[model samples]
Target: MSDATSPVPAAAPVARKVTSIGLGLLAVGGALSAWAFFDEDLRTRFGFGYMVGFTFAWAIVLGSLFFVALQHATASVWSVVLRRVAEMLASPMLILAVLYIPLLLVALLHPDSTIFPWRNPTSEMAEHAVHVKGSYLNETGFLVRTALFFSIWIFFTWFFVRGSLNQDGGRRADITERLRKFSGPFIILFAFTATFASFDWLMSLEPNWFSTIYGVYVFGGITLSALAAITLALSALKRSGLIAPELIRKDHLYSLGGLLFAFTCFWGYIAFSQYMLIWYANMPEETIYYTKRLSNGWAGVTVALAFVRFVIPFLFLLSRQVKTDERKLGMISIFILFGQLFDLYWLVMPNSFGEAGPGFGIPELGPVLFFCGVLLVAYGRFVRRHPVVAMGDPHFEASRGFRLH
Candidate 1:
């Protein structure tokens, strides 16, 4: 995909440099984790916290692939440039697969894991719930479903991105058509796989407590947070001279801002629905999930999640000017990113301690930064190796010229 007049050509050397730095961070992070593993208390808590933070960052990239797929399936015109941003964000899935090894070891090979309460054969929590759920929640099933989720996700993302890149050279309309056709079924498969993965990886933490709509709740945050992160990345690129500064027109930003706004509300609706039903039914099993989050210092985190993740984003993005301004949008994006981290922490950490809250410190901080490094490097490397713009899409020129009325 090399040409003299290409607007965003590949930068393989830079991608290699970024990938190397990412590897270095993983080394340091792993060493620190290994050192902490010698202490039993630190091992369980640190491992669990790291998984929470790593999954938090990893979800955004996976969510970006969903955006890209939906755009293709819908034949969205204005997102042609923006779609590239989503594509690059998805590169971290490759690394995330590598990261899952330790989690697998913890979940399947180890004697017990604090992160996955159901994995321990001897814990009272496991004894109470695992028997009932054992058929579905077995380690083999967990690993299999995880492998399937990533398989479906990674294959579709790779195919979709590779097709888009090929279009950069061939400019074949049929290529776009084939992609659009494939994207329809691919998205349905993605939804199914994501839902089951959520059930296995997250909801299983509590084991006994369950929600029918939990996957949808996770999906809402995934889409919204992914959009927010994309907005921030796009703004950074505009500022750094990576692409034409004027290329990120108000229309593009507006589309992103609109998704962010819509999903913020959607998240609130889903969360409220889940909480409402659980509260109304007052069943012991269903109530435990919310009860854990609402007690023992976690209450503060729950209220903060409502405001920071939903309320604040809702209020700010309500204004058309804020949605249209790159700086303002970027700020909101950063806030939403932090909200996602806090939100995941709220979801995963409390379960590890069992009716108590773990204080946040180096044990939590180190692994999170390490995983974030993996995500950052993967994204930076991806963008460097591909054109910033989907130059061959038929909608490319129209997207460039698009304006908000």
Candidate 2:
């Protein structure tokens, strides 16, 4: 018998059919995206959209890794039931690393590529500050540093995920201890990579503008969106009778709700602080970012982002009962996931399409749909390769029967 009140059963592998559906979607979405790239001007827009798309996907996967790492480092019993889902979430990283190539090609081969301002210097790029940034912002350094980030991400993702999967077959206690020991320092490594990666990829889009808390802002979105995605997946698994009853407890949902609530606040705080600091300083470079976003039809997106990402989630999740209700949680999860997309659009599209405003059609939505297909297929196959629940975890029962008190 397991240690906690409920005896948890090992979860069965996900169905192969689910993986097939995901693959089908990927193929269809990929075809549409390729077709869109034929128009020269549309191709440029696609290039920007491509970066945003992968970055959106990366944020969720890396965010899950952060959650899993944090839980392991703290020896958190209640979250053990959800750990496997989080692991599966991180499984898409290798494929994501593959998707990053186009962005690199845009930076390297296309002389007219303006997705990254520093990569192709214009008259604006010819300014004194651009020259000052020459050493750190060169094409060679950008590519090399990006490679380094991927090296760290792919290697560690394999290490952490492989350790968890190995536990399923062996049920080794030492394995758990090793993961615990590794996670503490790994969290620090995650922070550094996340910060610099944001700097290199997103902030560099507008070379002159910068925010000290930009990485944290990105972190908040990643964490919140990852949790939302997990909750939605958990709900789907439950509805299909795949998850064990004991694994879906009020306390566990409540914990997720608490986290969802907590991060919602953290995101707001970080956003307000970053905006306020920049507004107070009144520096030209710092002010430019908010100015573009606040004007040009983007201001509406900014408002909607606040409401969807923070206000609605925070308000809905405040009540204890709602978190425990799976259906309600699923709705909130979808909302937050959508919010992450809106927030990224607000941050990025304004730079390229500010004059034209937020335009949506097949052109805008194509790459995003394609990447989503990739995420689903990658995640489904990963879960199919192993048990959906971490039966080897010593804390499995405690997690299954976890209570908030």
Candidate 3:
């Protein structure tokens, strides 16, 4: 469609430069990853580190996909201008699918890998607590579930993204009707897939410790972080003169900032709800999860998460001036993204590092850099070729002047 031959705005050359820089970073990250793969000592560390990086990127991708679907499902006119960027952000699903192969291979071949305790249960796992759960925690089940999860995610992501791109060229009003028709059903599917995927990829890390609300907790971080990513990207495009200020007005940015504030509150509520219920019940099964995190220097990371995820964004965005100011909002969005990385780190690292606490050495940095490259390259290449805004959308004109009442 338009992605192939559209005459992009003045941003093409800049997007090309970004692609080049991403390639360089990918090369560096790939080299370090190879070293870590071959080195026996760093192999397990590499696996865990890669999970951190993968989840961080995965949240953004899934979040973007959700945002685009939500707007279509709600027929939200105010967010129409922002939807294209969300689509671009979600474009890396296949890349993530490919990256997951190594982790899957480890589960299948290297059963002794420490990254997934379920794959190689210890003697302690013989206890009834962990043993009983072994029915769903088996190797074959994990592989089958992983395949199912990716299939659902890839199909839906491709459907929404491709439909949007086709609309940009075909200029068919019927396309919008078809997308809206499917949006509701897709969301229902999204909820189940996202929840079970979190359990499979992350919560199962400890095997014995679990939370009924863990999926909701992960969902909060995913949407909040993805919104922040979209805001920052749109801000960058505006600053570079690729998108005119009037097209994506200050009021529109304020609307985005408002959503950021709302989801921050949602995240705070879920984080508190999960922790409060577990603390109140004080069961050995549930308490074990928080106990490890609250001890051995992990407490500091938890505190930082509280501030970044909730308190800081909650207070700062309350100001009308701040919400509308590109510079101010951009800063908070950057912090939120870093907070998302730390949040995922908190979830994934404590399982491996344990009493030693969090580690941020080369093993960790390598994968972070690699995924960062993947995001930049994926975004830059897509925006360079495609129309940056959904100009053919029926509501394009209406969204240009949309404002919060």
Candidate of highest TM-score: 3
Candidate 2 Cα deviation (angstroms), residue 352 = 1.9
lDDT of 3 by residue, 188-270 (tens): 98899889889989998888888889999999999998999999988887777767777888789888999999998999999
Which pairs of residues clash in candidate 1, taking residues 3 or more apart in a chain or in different chains?
Answer: none
lDDT against true structure, model 1: 0.79
Measured with C-alpha atoms, the lDDT of residue 398 in candidate 1 is 85
| Best candidate according to lDDT | 3
Tell me each candidate's RMSD, in Å, in order: 2.8, 4.3, 2.0
TM-score of every prediction relative to native: 0.92, 0.94, 0.96
Q: State which candidate, 1 or 2, has the greater TM-score.
A: 2
lDDT of 1 by residue, 163-195 (tens): 888888766999899889998998899789878
The lDDT of model 3 is 0.85
Ranking by lDDT: 3, 2, 1
Candidate 1, which ten residues in sequence have the lowest lDDT sum? 1-10
Per-candidate local distance difference test: 0.79, 0.81, 0.85
Write one digit per residue (lDDT tens) for candidate 2, span 1-405: 221222232222344445677777778768767876777768777777777777889989999889899999999999888788888888888888888897787645587777777765665666666778889888889888888888888887888888888888766888899999989998998898899888888888888877889999999999998998888887877776667766788888878878888998999899889989998999997898888887878788788888887888888988888888889988988988888888887777886686787776554677788888899888666655566678888888777778878
Model 3 alpha-carbon drift over 4 Å, by segment: 1-6
